[model samples]
Target: MLAVLAGCTGGSRDIGEGKPGSSGDAIQIFPRDGAEDVGPERRIEVSIPDGRLERVRVTRVEDARRQAVPGRISDDGLSWRPAGGAGRLALASKYSVEAVAVDAEGRRSARNTAFTTVVPDHRFIGYFKPENRSTVGTGMIVAFEFSRPIRDRAAVQKAIRVTADPAVEVVGHWFGRDRLDFRPAAYWKPGTEVTVEVGLRDVEGAPGVFGSQRRTVGFTVGRSQVSLVDAAGHTMQVRRDGELISTVPISAGAPKTPTYNGKMVVSEMHEVTRMDGRTVGFGGEYDIKDVPHAIRLTESGTFLHGNYWAPADTFGSLNTSHGCIGLRDVKGGGGSAPGGWFFDRTLIGDVVEVVNSPDRKVAPDNGLSGWNLSWQAWKAGSALR
Candidate 1:
């Protein structure tokens, strides 16, 4: 028998590293070495020292049905991106991964098949707005936009849960695309408490993006008082729970100032904003453009915001102006202005219900206020389950 240094490796002798045909040890999967409970958000990665990756094949160790072909390869060939897919690796199923690397001179280096028990967590998916751990005015949504559009959103919707320490009722609505908003149907029951838990990990979203993680977020739904404005009565009634708390008799808009009708989710709030006519589909016919210090409420130019030029009657009586929920105020969303008082107290997720106006339901895409659609209708728009 020929004497070959059995499994012996020496420094700088470097006699056998790249000698492909000499039967030197093949590359092995390093980190994922028997990695168990792998993240459902599995991002496949494999590396080779001297060889370039030719192809990767994923297969079920047992079931033939469980398999997928990864997407196109990149130019450098060092990394691969899946074509919006997970290789359908079975959940909690034993699996194997095979990677092939080739050298520039067509020298082939093979690695021993790496084995690991692929387990799935209680797959959860959620997002954080303002970038999750964020700080913004009460007007910002601590929104967790899903990585994928959620299927079974209703069932998952109920899961997003809010828990007020005081045990106030928290309801969440599924917004189109991938957003679920939790509120008390009113404003969050103020001063109570709030906790949101979305256990969507592994939960199947649209088709490709799976709910691969879970998350929790809780914010204070401060102050329960909400002011409801009636264009007909010209009375803005503030209420806590169900009782009228305060009434602001103010002008709204002239008939032409008709406020939008529907459940408006305060998508955003600005203490001051630059309002330009061209911004809201205004043409030269109505040259009065670019109103500043405006408290923009809805996306379609409607605002429970501040307007300077409009008269005070629009606050408590017939509507006027080009369809904005006007309030008695000056420049800027301040100045002890009646509009500022209401606007100041408002948060982004707060509810602004406009009634007695002829305007149609605000379009869903205009902002995050998609709850206006009936459950049946909302589901119809989904491209996937």
Candidate 2:
């Protein structure tokens, strides 16, 4: 009996240990162990030969946030990867991975690895408007302004997308290095639902600069209203669906400081605001304490507002004041004056075309005025096309 027991013990194999002559079966991981400066957009993966993956786990080390990683085994059962549920990794973060595999001979092998991603040196953000979820007019352009200049404009523009529910071809036009606007060739259809997506996360905007924005914004188009202002005529003709609604007499910019001649959008309206010329590069030419019914036209300090201080007789027949389209209004803006009525009728995205001005056309970058460019020119400005 002792002789038999000694022989059996010598031949017995330990469970969970690799079978004899199968030492070559092993698992390999990428972003190999102790890896650093890894891109967050990269996927985690494992490879096995002569074996099948049994389980895998990935966790963020900082807060112990277990990543929702869905893994898949290759058809041949020799490889596996975090397939679907796994989102892009966090920036400048450490992650841990654990995996187990079983060989064809039923021998099990396990592995554990950790890796770190690159710490972005510079960060970028995109500021967009008309405020998310707000309803705007058909001429509204979805605009974005970057906090810093973007060097990789083509790649950045590709990351941004816009879609309309009714399905219009939306295109993006870069105003400059830092500004971008998206719109259809013509005005949007009424009641159209528009969605803008900014998928810039982890994208290299420049050397050592990374974009950190992943957002989706939706807005609706309210109605169709277009107002035409003939600077030479000194009158504003309000129209809706090609029919005249109201005609209001107005005073435009003085000859020295002519109003920008082009199509502008009603960006915002304020019941009361202080106008300081110094704020717009003028050396204290005028500083009205309370300018009423102010509507922003251009970013270069041009406004269509109530001028309570100007002579009422000058509103319809003359060009007065500095680069502003002024309407006769009371000081308090309490009554239903011409300026208040216009302000009430106007909405964000309403188109205002200023024609026959002595001044030059507004720059496309000035306060969402991209409509000043021709359709061919606008499309030419897009990097995607």
Candidate 3:
């Protein structure tokens, strides 16, 4: 009956205005199938002849699941680019593409979807410190917060290096899960330059986490002034380049709360800083609320600063104070007062030893101070080649 309608037997007529073999067919995906070593963030483009790409979608690894990831179809309608999500393949197990295109008459057309393989065997981490391209005094540390914890800390520690002028060598030590610090065998030489380099790329950290840290941090070492305070002896000795420069009557912590021991590096010298007893477990059930002009000596709430409330007669004679080292000084870190003169001559990296304080040296990881760490231990935390 159809042949009779066509007026010819066994003859056929094609439908619509589209030529034979016109679009609405499967679009081709480049890179082919079963391809290996594809980057985790590869893009699959589409080719269309008589239509414009309306939408592009992707499927999960199993091919049974589908999702619409973000990407843009080129304005010319010739190519498409995949704008993967944050962390790229890190957020997805696998993905494939399914594109849709529309012709002139609002006719919809879609192509056969192609699956792309996702291999996420790569890892990355950061080596970031708080100091950003600035000169930090002895109070700052050559530190790095790793993005991932290392599988073998000893292996990674080998990649962290520190070099200083005047032939001062330092080491990198592990701090907690993801922090490492570098410090010299002694305090950095005053007026010297220090540089730290960490190469942690492709380094295997903990399970499934990789290290991607590659950076060089540099800072200048200021001055060397190592002072010794013996509360029992009722004397404080200040030395510059091994020369006995000055002596002041300095009081230290009483028996109840002593200062910390070890290589104590001067971190901050504020003319005044508010100290709260509640913050550091002082003032019993209540907080002192304010300890003014407190110079942070250690990370653990220790300060060698002016004590206006203490007896002036005990300035150089007695060890009678709270947990702080008390020195007589004006309101600022300068002027004729013994404390101010001492502060003016002191620079970063200068050492101040409170021999009788019962507290401990601040932990290397507690803050910017790194003097508590030994060079050998510091060198044992790198995760690089």
Candidate 4:
């Protein structure tokens, strides 16, 4: 019986031959197929440890509309994400993703998947400036104006970050519940690349108010151009990186309504605009229907504009008009007028440093100008220090 059992055990069945070949390293995709109710603010990530992503295509399912999801692959050829490492899918939409990758050995792998994003009950986003991809002078400030007032200022401030490529310590100062501005201790370094990141998604900004902005904006700081205005001397000196470029005669605010003496940024410029004193609280004092080469300095209606109506002799010699800086120019703002020349040369964010004026310094919240406060005092205005 033992010999019979040994003979039975020796007759083992032949196991099937191993499969012929193999597939390359598999591509990994997030939000797996059939995934439902995914967060719209979530980023789509893809990776393959042994492979480099060759192509990635994401599109809406219903209309097959291709989503412009810009992606960057790692140098090691293992992972890929949005160019900024952040993004958001469209709400209440189904997305289909297809990816192709190649391994180190040149073997290819592919993946296809689909997912749906959650439709939010409430959504909020931030409105920020200097415009994305804009180039401006060194005094640019990263300012945001939310659609709704924020109740939790500290939390909101924490979600927003301002960074410089050369690495400077940037801080935020809240002008009010709905407005926040960021800047360095001094003006931004010339030619610095500034990036503004807003990561406010799903944040409880107010009582039951949810934020849904996950965006990045970038701008370049051009040359360091600052203008020194001597209200007492009735002259303006333009400086580039601390060197005098040009000097022009000017008229500041009258003695009773002196111009604010402080550092102010050129927040805006318009070729022609109407200046009505009644609109700025000095009811019916002066109403010039069309002012040319107007550059706005403050939110409180302070402007440096071409005053063709004022007497030509008053521009260089005497202080006239209401509380505004006046330059000589024609009605249409063309030709060799000093105002047009200055306006053409200057960009937004250029600094206007007013000295020897009788009035008080401009308020920090007056437009994007006014860096008059000490660093300590400015930091004191921050919710997080």
How many pairs collide in each candidate, listed in order? 29, 0, 20, 0
Query: Number of the top candidate by lDDT?
Result: 2
lDDT of each: 0.48, 0.71, 0.52, 0.70
Model 1 regions lying over 4 Å from their true place: 1-148, 151-161, 168-177, 183-188, 199-204, 211-214, 240-246, 249-257, 285-296, 312-314, 332-334, 361-385
Q: Encode model 2's per-residue lDDT on 232-325: one tens digit a residue.
A: 8989999987789988898786676677799999876766554544434443344453456777777665778776666667767877555778
lDDT of 4 by residue, 164-251 (tens): 9899999988877888888898888888999888889888888887887777778899999999989899999999988998898888
Residue-level error in angstroms, candidate 4, position 167? 1.1
User: Estimated TM-score per prediction?
Assistant: 0.51, 0.68, 0.56, 0.67
Q: lDDT tens digits, residues 203-313, model 1?
A: 565554456545665555454444577767877786655687667764454454356666665644544332323323432223211222244445454555555555555
**Considering TM-score, which of the candidate structures 3 and 4 is the better prediction for this target?**
4
Clashes of 4: 0
Q: Which stretches of candidate 4 lie over 4 Å from their true place?
A: 1-122
TM-score, prediction 1: 0.51
